[model samples]
Target: MGTAERINSSQRTLPYVEIMDSTLRDGEQTNGVSFLPHEKLMVARMLLHDVNVDRIEVASARVSEGEKEAVRMICRYADQIGKLDRVEVLGFVDGHLSVDWITDCGGKVINLLAKGSLKHCTHQLQKTPENHIADIKETVEYATSKGLSVNLYLEDWSNGMKDSPEYVYQLMDELSSVSTIKRFMLPDTLGVMNPLQVIEYFRKMIKRYPDIHFDFHAHNDYDLAVSNSLAAVLSGAKGLHVTVNGLGERCGNAPMASVQAILKDQFHAKTGIVEDQLNGISRLVEGYSGIAVAPNQPIVGENVFTQVAGVHADGDTKDKLYYNELIPERFGRKREYALGKNSGKANIAKNLEELGLELTPEQTKRVTQRITELGDKKEIVTQEDLPYIVSDVLKHDAPEDKVKLISYVVSTAYGLKPGANIKVEINGQQYDGSAVGDGQYDAFVKALRYIYKKYLNRTFPILANYQVSIPPGGRTDALVQTVITWHYNDGLLRTRGLDADQTEAAIKATFKMLNIVESNL
Candidate 1:
């Protein structure tokens, strides 16, 4: 089907999505990484303002002096801006320590963690249900007196509700009637339940406490976090908890991107999710946290919406038969076609559409076979390198190889600046350039840009992105591949180059960029 005829069948009127960003709180708990005081404040502001997450859990109160200082700065900013209600902190059940810390930090809301499972209550706390109930009551009462809103977390409510229903019901009964309790946040602490269990447990709670607001939090131990979250919502959950890119402890929390998409598409649920900002926000979190987002991650992963099989690409051409509700555009991405062992003429055609080129059926078949052979050798073939593959397959010089790099010399030493001298021919015209820069690659690009702007009188494309990759195996002389993306007035242009040396790989790709620009001109 034509792009003009595409329909957004995923969206219908649904309950508003309540986004709770945990990037500062649970996200910081990621091993070996901690955002400094100002970093937490910066992320908090961005989460609330740019991404428009409804709520943010800034930090845990009383964790450490650094944590306290971080929350203090965040709350100071949040309070002056009247976002006190939206900024929350996780606090323990310790009597005055948590409450005092939160108040001092200018935090208004506290998610008080309490034991729900029988094992934790009996083993960890070594207290009976009645005694624990009294402790919670005192803590809630104290927090209320301090003008802090209280939310109780039945730490492992699912397990408690299943194994010790009597104790769980009695505690909920008392807390539901408490004058200071604003909400009851239920957590499947160990992530033991399925969707059916979530439905059963949530129904019981809603029936028992008809007036209380309940927020359901999920974990992905069973990989059913998304399904169970939906089940909770269907059974009358007032709100749900989500972390951007699923940044949490073991197995990660439910990914906000997937939860938001599934809810809006299948369940017809509405959320305040800025559908377009999902990728950028995920990238920012990945960069700040130093965690590599897996390529197969549900919503924001690189390959989630890509079609790798040739049959799928062919089916996509015929009214988009291969598509489901998760269209890439919905989450600020585009569908991509992969060309490798599984590719056919259809996949090649789809990629050709993007590069503004077409080929005869015979030529496309030949190119597909060549890609498959390369894939069999474990070589990744990207669309940026498709022209070179086609040139090898059809012997046509790729239509954009008018510029070629003749040779280059670059040197880097321990205590000295990096420098480079490069020679290239553009449109059969030779240009020699040299420069010293932050690094050899930087020097090379600067010299090339000088030649383009000063002598050729042309506007150089900005390097939007540059990435280098080598195969997983350890080989000192392994081939390095460099991909460069150039941004100009019309749009972006990408090119790839491969060589045994890293610097040569980058230089080869730069030469391809020059040729692409010349061809366009």
Candidate 2:
């Protein structure tokens, strides 16, 4: 067939693209990432119900008993909701084993994996093209007989298109007769293709068989998956394969978030994805996979929506000059201005605006300077830490700590719970308290609580979280930075301290919190 003959005569200006999220199967190929059966089911539900992805490949055929159970669980739920056709399983070109495995697990679709590259077909399977075609024919026949719909995966299709176009065309020519095949999936198995190659090759395939539904699966070996996917779409490809957090083997597949964003913004193609649920699903996958995404990963990363430069925040205030189409609100996230040495007055003002606090111009300048100084010490200033810093910098005569820790002795022995004895002063009144706890810091907090409740008649703030970190290449005498978050008055407060001992560092942070609470009171 020639290019002119293969072009779709009724093609529209912009194609309606389908999104197939393989977060469960290909995403599980990510190193050190595995979801439990229930976790897989939960992810499947969210991807289908919340994210509204058109289809989900749940698992590979006959991997393990655990994988089977996970697949079966997801299939059961998908079946109950009348969406069993939306769930698919990856299968080999084995005659009936893959088909039977999928059928037994309640899966209705089998994405049969076949070699697209002549090298993979010849070396990986050590079979000639003729024999490989025979195997795939038998597999398709068996799958169809078992009442399963089928999609064909041309694994390593990019290399195939480059090095063995004849072999690729030959395989497609043979499989074109398989009328039950729903779609043909082409994978850049080695992550080697660039956008130009994708466009060139995809156009060739589309021109050859414009009638066949084609899906492009990209890998991020060169950080080009998103670009390549867009190129494929521009070349008239019909579908995309993606994973949440870009989880897959090696460099992973194209990230669902990035692909969706580009398809809508650049290509003007439409997908069924609900943009608001993208971040929620990304976080869920990250937690289950135990893989922390880079802070700068597009769309769903932690700092992608953060304005770290003062100029950027300043532009944002003046009619969103620094903003783009990828607004944080579109993904159910709020923009943040980082507080650090790089932060400018505009950045501080932005944070203050979020906190609903008004400060004089001088006060804002002093606070910004103090934040920069703290940042110079490599300290992280969270929004929760701003009020305390402001009070400390503004008050010339530091407010007397109404509740003061006069003395404390904490000890941890080999077989006993840690114990603390503490003396505190409140309004010139003295109180001594002792307590035992799971740790020395816990005991100290308990003793302090005793004084607050019994002697001072006040409510102590609840410790919500505590984190301790030593600098890189930690040494025995290295300073430990302890940041403690406290809950008070329906809000959160954070304070930090540095010392050689972790417990002492926490205590110093607690002392800072004490003064903060006192100043506020």
Candidate with the greatest TM-score versus the true structure:
1
Worst 10 residues of 1 by lDDT: 4-13
How many collisions between residues are there in candidate 1? 2
| Model 2 residue 257 CA deviation in Å | 0.9
TM-score of 2: 0.80
Per-residue accuracy of model 1 over 288-372 as CA lDDT, tens digit each: 7878789999889978988999999999999999999888887777789887888888888999887877888888888888989
lDDT of 2 by residue, 232-326 (tens): 88787888999999999999999999999877876568889999999989988988998988989999987898898899999988998998899
- Candidate 2 residue 358 C-alpha distance from true site, Å: 2.0
Per-model tally of clashing residue pairs? 2, 0
Task: List residue ranges in candidate 1 displaced over 4 A.
Answer: 1-14, 37-42, 76-82, 398-466, 472-477, 485-492
* Candidate 1 vs. true structure, TM-score: 0.86
- TM for every model, in the order presented, reads 0.86, 0.80
